[model samples]
Target chain A: MNAFTRFASLFGAGKDASGRGGSSPECRRVGEVLQMYLDGEFDGDTSWLTDHLDECADCGLDSAEFQQLKDAISRLGQPDTDTRQRLQEFADHLAGGEMDVVDDPV
Target chain B: MEAAQTERDAAFRSYVVPELDVMFRVAMSLTRNKADAEDLVQDALVRAYRAIDRFDGRYPRAWLLTILRNAQINRTRRRRPELLHDPDTEMERLSSTKSGDEFDPEAVVIDPVFDASVRQALDALPKKFRRPVELVDLGGLSYQEAADDMGVPVGTVMSRLHRARKRMRDHLEQTGFGTREID
Candidate 1:
């Protein structure tokens, strides 16, 4: 099986005969707030979540994946040099009262 | 009058000039097109200039970002209605570049293939999901700031942004993105 199938099977292992994955309640709770925890926006106590992440391999991997995704997304924010230069010049003109505001034609 | 005009110009330079790059980045996040983003920033700057005399000069970045958000909303309202969703057009606009030769090598932190996959995953997301990601991740807005811009409550922003990232993560994993080296 490929990596994806393998990773998915790990989650699948939590399922019981009823096909309701028997993952611990802690795991379920962690899953609910993992994004907020990673984003540093979680307001409540985080000690339990941290403890759970340390003990649960599956939850740890999930956290790592989310962190990686965030890092990748952050890299796209850099503005190119030409755009910066154009904006700088425009700001100069606007501040100097050299440019007039014209409505965009509909 | 001349002295007052000079003082207004100085104040504009001091308060608004430093934020031009940030304004463009947020505009790009909202519009997802280079030319359209530039136009949006232009409009916002015009508004800022016109109102500079009345600005209280506190929390300039917040004030400027609010102006930028309003400008984007107005621009959206003025546009001709989109008849139908076109994935190809959406992808093109999301990946739009002003010049091929203007590449910045330092900006790339991961493999091009991985980055392309991430962009594709981002492109495939529904607009409601995609906007939160773009605003928070690509535009570097805090959750509260993004919430304010979208006119939604903080809790709603948190929920949507979390769900959006989860969807993107699922997409990446399905594409074997997790197998790559991550550091």
Candidate 2:
């Protein structure tokens, strides 16, 4: 493990941790599984989290809040079509080419 | 040099041009400022051109994002002096979390304050946690991909990502708007 990983391992093991199958490969917690869920990596019914989410209202709320947060974060930083044109012109100049794509673009 | 530029221009047109919006959005997610995002995207585009020869041309968006992420980091590292250590100060102001005393996620569908809350919560994360979250959550990189990009284990990525999200939720809970754990 790298220094950061080792540091994380030292200080990172305890907050809100409710893991299963400790010291085993299949071990996962609400935190880890919830990460997968937000990443769209959770295999739905096949995921180990399925059972936990069904039984734990807290985890269920965690799931919903994470989904909502993901949507919120995803909706940020939207750029219009003109942004592409502007960036392309910038790239052209950065490429040692003239700014011929968009005339007099600032 | 001229001939290589010509070839790079063609390759860039084919591979990179289509992904400008993705790069911009990813830049915005990191910078949280339109002006900064634009500047970062321009830097990344320049770096991408310089490194375009190394890219295999598939997964153009991913390739550009990697470049953009690195550019942002380098920029952050360079500008960070002892007096200006915290790079997030500027971003936090842009999101302006002053109104998050009652940040409601459900009520945030059209609320800028809720938007600020989410961004502020992300800003509050430790570097170890935030990097993976930004890579996987914001940049849409996969576990293995984020692991490789961040040079950490896949388990580490998952661990940090989940921890970061949990912390974000906890912050939202503190804001008096989101659901809190039943304890």
Most TM-score-accurate candidate: 1
Task: Estimate, for each residue in A57-96, the C-alpha lDDT of model 2 and write its tens digit.
Answer: 4455445556667766664555544565678677656554
lDDT of 2 by residue, B105-129 (tens): 3433355555556777887888898
TM-score of chain A of each: 0.56, 0.41
Model 1 residue A68 CA deviation (Å) reads 2.4
Q: After superposition, how far is residue A27 of candidate 2 from its true place, in Å?
A: 15
TM-score of structure candidate 2: 0.64
Tens digit per residue, CA lDDT, model 1, B10-84: 988999998887787788677765667888888888888878889999978789999998988887777776823
Quality class of the docking in candidate 1, CAPRI style = acceptable
Any runs in candidate 2 off by more than 4 Å, and if so which? A1-34, A43-60, A80-85, A88-97, A100-106, B1-6, B58-66, B73-109, B178-183
Worst 10 residues of 1 chain B by lDDT: B94-103
Docking class of 2: incorrect
